[model samples]
Target: MTTTTATAEATTATDVLIVGAGPTGLTLACTLARAGAAVRIIDKSPEPHRASRGKGLNQRSRELFDDLGAGAEAAAWGTERVTLRKYRDGVAIADTVAFGDRTPTPDTPYASGLLIPQWRTEEVLRRTLARYGVEPEFGRELTGFTQGADGVVATLADGRRIKAAYLVGCDGGRSPVRKALDVTFEGRTDTEECMVIGDVRVDGLDPAYWHQWFDEDAAVMLCPFRGSTHWQLQGMPERDADGRALPPSLESFQRLVDRCSRRTDIRLSDPTWFSVYRINVRMADRFRTGRVLLAGDAAHVHSIAGGLGMNTGIQDAFNLGWKLAYVVRGLASPGLLDTYEEERLPVAAWTLGLTEERLRAVTEGVKQAGVGTEAVVTDDVTTLGVGYSWSSLAWGGAKAGERAPDGPCGDGRLFDVFAGPHFTLLGFGRGSAQALAEAGEKCADRLRTCLVDDPTGHARRAYGIGEGEDALVLVRPDNHIALSAGADRGAEIADRLLRLGR
Candidate 1:
């Protein structure tokens, strides 16, 4: 490949060139680096983001972080069991638990979400990425790119060129890569509906609950950031006489809070970050065009009603990481990369619809029933139940394409065995040991084989294997079951493995 810019100083090469250093891009970089892919990640911003943009991690995303070796650190900085305190006319009306009700089961270890700042989550990811000897190159912006049959050549703002086998756009909603591809972003932006959001320090306010005050026309919410004195503030944007929304400022935030809560004891100051948030429900027409792909907000965006924005992006990186790594490593054909969009596109569509519904519920519920935004919260928001059974890779029964459940195996849990940059094969009974051994010997570098010896039968039950029945399960690197079959079908198992790029 050749660059169009003659002034391009030098050409650097890598297996993958990722644009954007946000949570999604950082997660992808960590995954690819751990999988031994030569990755180069860059961001236009000179420094890491300091704002707490998306302030929560769902159960599914927590699992992804755990696999990346950053889960414990993220959890340490997060707060669980936070109470939602509602107020009306400065009087406390109701108090409800947000994520404290869920209990962890053997099959689902992370049943609850964590409340952590977005900047903190990015920090954890960056720390993990450093372990793999890769760091995002900040202030290196992608000015343009050209892709040929073999690879892509990206031109940066500094007149440098990066040649890579693949390019992924993890940039936010206004993605330059997506625009360069001429891809259509299909959906609408609700400019009329806007909110002023920021992180601020408050004095004389208790941090025990996520305080929310609601009146007939407006509302203000202050959620304390876990492990920090700062809190995230969200309220209606102040509008001028002509109905134009004013720019967000510390004074305007204070006025909104005082008017909504009717409280004089609270004081707000030291605004670290602030922005005007508008709902944009949109998704790219396609996730891929030749050697370039899109992930995270570059692919889809929705309302922040259910806090699914960042979690969905994290999950997107998890799903694409393994497939992209395999293709780069020559373990799979380029066609394997197509499955990334096939599997995740539907998920993005579902999330857009779900969040839009929740946004409507919050708006209408507040006016009709005096309900808070917490009314939008549901078990579905956890994303634990999301599956891709309809994908072409999913084969044989309901368990296929579903997330591999965690259960007790030997001394540790199933996740302990599944955590890594390799696929997993679980032989449920002695009858399947031979097949497991053969598959392991053939694909030793890319697959991990386990013979479950769970006396409590919890693992078998979670996997949908009947008591005393023999079965073989093949799980993808991302921990989704690719296929399952009877133990006796050893030849079929081998055939499927070979077809899956073993």
Candidate 2:
């Protein structure tokens, strides 16, 4: 209800105050702003850095951007990676493998992963956020926050305060917001987290290929970056001569690369970014608390096996954005915010498990044997397939547990009939037209009802309707099929949301 401008007053207000301007926070801010929510996003850093971290944008994430009109721009920054060749035992045996078949079906537009580095992804998000007329408040940190029945209030380091209907923590693992909430972060560090990561400017190297050497003791990964022949090299860190884990000296880094590939011919110049680190797999206790919530790295973090970090966080923002905006706009009940945790928490846990499995595969020598590189890319669970197991609109009209597959559809236009993160009704034939019309009247604001372009009337039968037969499909905001029924009888659809929220 109130906000303040005085730094000494320590009170300001927003519909939502998001902490951390990384992929997750920024995405949520963009969505909320577009939907007309008063949002404020802050980060501890003063500026966006060029350090590229997670570098892969999965198919689902790209589709998410397309809905917001930024997909094409985001897509342009990434290159498609068809295969990842891993040579075992220091020998270059298995080569490049073809892996493109597993993508979006005809109904969906994006199917493949775009291999753009994380820094560029942030740049694209920044550009899109500007269109919303809200730029992230960098260098602004959340000192702590407390919640009340009406809203939440967050404090900045200089003692400024912000009041908001809700507060979301998308900050990284060392999240100040999450820490203030005192939520438990569970899971072990996988003690054998033997991984060293850094970026380097490699001269004279083809900046198109990803080279992996799974040698005797160490595993090395080299990815060629765009705009420069410089590559991002990652490998297991070696202990110093005294057995202490030391930073990778220039000589050690070059030697590690040389030993893994069995080649000292390629020279290593000054490194751009250098760091030796351990990988830990962890997730939060819960994603919500009263008016405060957690997302992205603040909620969960895992091994970077398939480049799922940024993608997972970005999706978290997508899942929470519309919900927060709708509630903020008073268009929906406040219960919608609960769905953010129910839907995204499982996704985070699933991703953690998937990445752990992949980490094991590489660390434990679990190879496909006969399955080539193509299989690995799809089999790599870091690429997501998240669904709402607890939302009200759980039944897709066609079948139970069947996702809303993007298809040629009852519509004639190729990829034209797209359902977004909301409720939609597709009427096939005129059979169930009455039912659709009736249902459309009840929830005109919450659901979309349309007659399928069925000239032959097969759509009506397929939708469980007789001649002039019409059936209804209820889609969730995430574009997943929830339920399909006759228009008048579909009142029970609201009951599903009740159960999910309760």
Candidate 3:
């Protein structure tokens, strides 16, 4: 049912084909390939560019990378910010708040945001892929595609073709693959303010703390970057008597900074790169069409209010990776695909609402002419708060338990189950070991089972796992619990895993 055109010279067939080589695409390719998938990634660009955008990686994204065996590289590239300070009209308002401590999560490791440019992140992921002997197929582009029940026939712009079982569109806002799927990206664009984003070396700004400056006229934000002396400055350019957009120039930017900071003597230099973009909160009505799907910007686009854009995309890949691997390995049913939208769609909507609320608060604060200090930047409302309610794969109700929370468990040392690639069974009483041992055998080729033993039992109370409880929990490989049947229902856990995809 699939055919390759003469142009796809790299291979006759690929298990998974990904369009676009941005962070989201590359991350999905990496996840799929690492699990023994034959993944091929193509981008129109011949090489990666030097433009530095999205200066901060939220807590959820950092944790995902750590799980994929690249945490050290991420740490080497980013500096941690311990304190967050708020400013008002060139004067101090509320003191700095300590919000940088990493916390426990259901599946991931990183608990705080790390300062790093978008390019640096791609570099690490590229290297990680190279280690596995899979180089990205750059300079190639997808022109058209036809889908069938078995696979898809994708044509290349240069007359080449490839047959793939599945395809993920990680391309940016203007995604060709998403267009081919005929999905509607529903949302509106806000032109009130276009952000001028850039990274540079500043002569005298402390990197340990994040600083914000707010004034009646304009605002200035300076945050720490991975490299020494380099800082990301997002400045609102000054306008004339007319309300026309100001041409963002060096002197104009400096004057705005000086007027807000009251530091006219401070000199600035070395402009790396700058761009103006109006943030649009948009998304596809459906995440997947047949075997072709979307993630990251291809699926959702929103403001930088929570620094959660890229992080949400990365987590989306994480959420899909394990499921795809299991289904590809013939261990789960195809029914798993529906859960992707049911779980992630609502999360994206919540994030859009939260970011809009944050933007509104900042706009109101600007009208009042005070620094929008309390409007904390985050994309977590979309990234971390994601949970599945309508998933046929997940057991629903209080019997469904509290959608599984992340906290300190086991012996004294804190641990998260996802430190390894496996499904975890959390129990408060006896009979859990037996339940998992049985599920492990039934889905031995698909799910790896682990029992999180917490003698202290605080974890049980926190997750509503009652003491002397007689229930057996079934967590997916991605760390989301699929079922929480009582101890008498251990056999049902394995049954659910086997019958889930059908």
By lDDT, the best candidate is: 1
TM-scores, each model vs. reference: 0.96, 0.86, 0.87
Q: What is the lDDT of residue 129 in candidate 3?
A: 78
Candidate 3 local lDDT, 1-502, one digit each (tens): 2223323333328778888887888778778777777788888888885556766667657766866777779889886654655667666565444344445444344556676888888888888878777888888878887777777778888988778778788888888877777789999997876766565566666667666787666678776665646667787866668766676666766776788788765556777766676879898899988777888889999887766778777877877877676666666677777677777777778777877887776677655433453455453442444666566666743435223555555642223454444566655466677876776787776566556666666566655666777566666655566777676666776676677667
CA shift at 453, candidate 1, in angstroms? 1.6
Ten-residue stretch with the least lDDT total in model 3: 1-10
Model 3 misplaced stretches (Cα beyond 4 Å): 1-12, 85-95, 98-111, 238-242, 366-370, 377-383, 397-403, 407-416
lDDT of candidate 2 over 42-97, digit per residue (tens): 98898886666777787778767776667888777677754555666555566563
lDDT of 2: 0.69
Q: Kindly list the per-residue Cα lDDT of model 1 for residues 1-502, writing each as its tens digit.
A: 2323223443437999999999999999999999999999999999998899999998899988988899999999998767888888778888877766778999998767899999999999999999999999999999999887778889898998888889999999999999988889999998898999999999878898899888888789999987787899999989999999999999999999889878787999999999999989999999999989999999999999899999999999999998889888877778888889999999999999999898888888766433577777798898988888998889776499999999999999889899888988899989889988888887777889999989999999998998888898888888998888888765676666566643
- Lowest-scoring 10 consecutive residues by lDDT in candidate 1? 1-10
TM-score comparison, 1 vs 2, better candidate: 1
For each candidate, what is the lDDT? 0.88, 0.69, 0.69
Question: Sort by lDDT, best first: what order?
Answer: 1, 3, 2
Clashes of each: 0, 22, 12
lDDT of model number 3: 0.69
lDDT-superior candidate, 1 or 3: 1
Query: Which 10-residue span in candidate 2 carries the lowest summed lDDT?
Result: 1-10
